[model samples]
Target: MPFQGRVVDIAVDEVDLGAAGVVRREYTNHPGSVIVVALDDDGNVLLLRQYRHPVGAFLWELPAGLLDIDGEDPHIAAARELAEEADVRAARWDVLVDLLPSPGGSNEATRVFLARDLTPVPEPERHTREAEEADMVAVPVPLEEAAALALAGHLHNGPTVSGILAAVIGRANSWRTLRPVTSPWEYRRN
Candidate 1:
């Protein structure tokens, strides 16, 4: 079935669940995505303010990009997004969180990475900013402050809020809970 309001294919499937009989699941087919919490040596996180039309206002978010490039590793995608969107490179990267953004509706899986050891790159090497990103602004917010704002209902972006909270708690736990950048991403395996 074709549902053509977006670039990706959207379809409905009838799935059997044993004694549960069959149910229809309608969802948007999506390639996975990656979010980068570019953490600076000063304990600040890179924040991007970009206009999200659906949200009706500019919202705060971390550097992130879709993992749509065929055959690109998630880590490599994250690295590219960091450089392209923020004009920075990270020497250290670790998986902060793996997400199923809307389990009931879509198979969109996202991985959030904690990026450290930042170094600025030359403008020529950056991705040409287009659309919303052309007027977007990047700001460095202290981690704790970002967490505080998130808790206070100011930071509303889902991935950004989740990433900030995870980073704060992960730090308190000595980041023992974070997985390696190369760790298996189950959803992506499909």
Candidate 2:
């Protein structure tokens, strides 16, 4: 490991290709993450405006967090993030899409979940906020409007954009295209 941080690490590797020869590659070693798209019966999706220091801006994003705990299920992690970040709990969850945000530079595998039948998390049960999370505010936007914001470039977060689009497609398909919440994660396995 070239560098290691609390949540991520940097690594350099050598790869051998029979015809192309050997090459050296440097990438971020990630533990994967989960994003939640919480949709209510009123067609509104729960969102968060949180400060992303790396980007130096408060961006509209879905409730998301790293899969940091060893042996923890991604579905459970998603549920935890939703309540922690959005102060809500989802009664139903389905895998919306899997993403390789920056496959060329990092092995960050992200799973976006479509959450429905939502309910507010009791005040005492909500997660304590810290750092940037302390300033986050949960906002609900209509599904179509959120998509427009994404296309208009007002919302630039990758996973949020992808999750919104995927949710739209899933809704159009009557959610039949959504994978089960317990679906095996393929990217992390390798």
Candidate No. with top lDDT: 2
Looking at model 1, which ten-residue stretch has the lowest summed lDDT?
1-10
For model 1, the superposed segments whose C-alpha errors exceed 4 Å read 4-7
Compose the digit string of candidate 2's lDDT tens values, residues 55-112: 8988899999999999989999999999999999999989999999999999999999
Instruction: Please give the CA lDDT of all the candidate structures.
Output: 0.89, 0.93
Q: Estimate the TM-score for candidate 2.
A: 0.97
Model 1: lDDT of residue 54: 82
Error of 1 at 88 (Å): 0.8
